[model samples]
Target: SSPLDPRYTFENFVEGASNRLALAAARQVADGSASGVKFNPLYIHSSVGQGKTHLLQALTHRLKAEHPEMRVLYLTAEHFMYRFVQSLQTQSALAFKEALRTIDLLVIDDMQFLHGKQIQQEFCHTVNTLIDGARQVIVAADRPPVELETMDERVRSRLSGGLLIEIGAPDAATRRSIIERRIALTAQHMPGFSVPDDVIDFIVRNVTTSGRDLEGAVTRLAGHNQLTGLTLSLTMAETTLKDLIRVTDTRRVKIEDIQRVVSKHYNVSKQDLLSSRRTRSIVWPRQIAMYLAKSLTLRSLPEIGRRFGGRDHTTVLHAVRKVEEMIGSDEALTQEIEVLKRMLEA
Candidate 1:
């Protein structure tokens, strides 16, 4: 069988202001010259489609190319949990320990899924073994250790001890570059066809967040054009991704729905969401929920504020603006918001 390809290597990754630091850090880790590199277990946290997995895979590929003898294994946290569970069920826990112990490098993706005490304990043991043996360990997740409510304290502390890096959403320029790069790749595969610059610009403008969604838009447009024997244009691209572009489609989401979903996800009482608690935990989720309600629903700022515990309309405006700035730069918060969005949509 052919080997699986890395999705977010240096070649395909679009460097931008949002992820420049993270990209540089990954490169440094790969080069083995990063100062105070005691944090061998580099933790990358980001929202889905923000290229966390891509960066992780890229790092692994680079390390393998530079150090082929390094035993590198890249799997999701779910896979880790599954394997650990299977080992116990099959009475082969020793084999699982030995297998993991022998690896020189381990990369686990989507580590937020690694919940439960037993799985976390096993992971802690594996992490300690790797660290004590001077092995490289990298983990990617949707949120930082401190915010992972389902994780055990010991596991969370261990993860926090390592170098924690957050990969934020791409900016406008980065989004444009990503569209261009994907269009180029599509052209290579489709030979006779090409995506116009105007269509690229339209995509970059409308798909204001999430590189994954942007790529999906490009791919969908290319596929639709090819299948229907039609030209790819800005209008057609918009029509193709109408669902994605219409963020304010009230039929799809409501202010009440946002409040409910956010409240449920964070396990915060509806009262707390309505309360003026200004605590980081409450304030962050409240702002995000307010932003979603205003952006996704046709609700007025006053209405959204009323839904979120009787804050003034200005407070809602501030919350939306704050979340907008945060979505551009804060990786962990972005992931949490994305998760809330998915739950609302689902």
Candidate 2:
């Protein structure tokens, strides 16, 4: 009834290659005997629709069910701000503080919205009081603490001090599994509707960004099939979701644009990426920038290298190769590059 309530407990969460480590960490924290056993103030960050809120809610619900005596409070950033503002207006700040301080577990979702100086100050005070009093705090956001722009330094530092975990976008296998799970759930609602495996594969391949997109596609397919008395087919699904599938336009991002985006993301001068500095940080970003430049632009290696501070074509080749390997192996790095690519294209 309510969008399938994504908060699956640890028992229901499907383990896959994409989120095995994160699931383990969450389980450890939830089952920890004393406060701060495995991870205190667990911070989960991910892009939209990657199950961050689901995991946070699941943890909160599981803890409350297991320990009936523990007090838990869960609120989104907007709700938290609203309550804080209302308390100030009604002269009830102390009451709000007291209620929050007495909770055994505090869960905040979409914390990136609370970036104002005043709100951040209040958040810092709340965090300090809860941690000092040995209460567990869990926060979710779209980005990590260090990357949170406009947030107070004290709040950012405190958030980063705890265990920080990031959930990556679902890979092809994970997406396929998600598609199957959603289709099965949909079948429960619509007994006569069915989707073929090829259709599922097609949806997974095309909508490869996030789990939310996949679920939306499945729901749309189920609804259309029910309304029109039509069988779900690959062609129909494609036609229905033409806008959701992102087709890269080679003309949009040029080599120079890629370099500019990468430089800005890393906060390094364009010359640094082009320079012969073998530092790990610079080297990886440089390679990724070059790889994106070559992939997105019509420029040759020599031309791209020349644009990046007169480096040799062979250097550009090496950087491209290294980045390709890293993207295939390192999930976090792949997501970082994908985010940069999205920004560059936008």
- Give per-residue CA lDDT, model 2, range 1-346, as digits (tens): 0122444666556566767766776666566553563466788887777777777667666777787787878888878888888898999998988898888778888888885678779888888888887778888887788756467999999999988888876788888888888888888878866798888878877886677788888888888898889888888998987866774444346566787888889888888887889888788778888899888765678877777778899988998998899889999998998898788766
Give per-model CA RMSD: 10.5, 10.4
lDDT of 1 by residue, 253-321 (tens): 656677778888878877888898878888877887889887776567876766677789999999899
TM-score of 1: 0.71
TM-score result, candidate 2: 0.72
Q: Once superposed on the true structure, which residue ranges of model 2 sit more than 4 Å away at CA?
A: 1-8, 33-38, 247-346
**C-alpha lDDT (0 to 100) for residue 303 of candidate 1:** 64
Stretches of model 1 off by over 4 angstroms after superposition: 1-3, 35-38, 247-346
Task: Report lDDT per candidate.
Answer: 0.80, 0.78
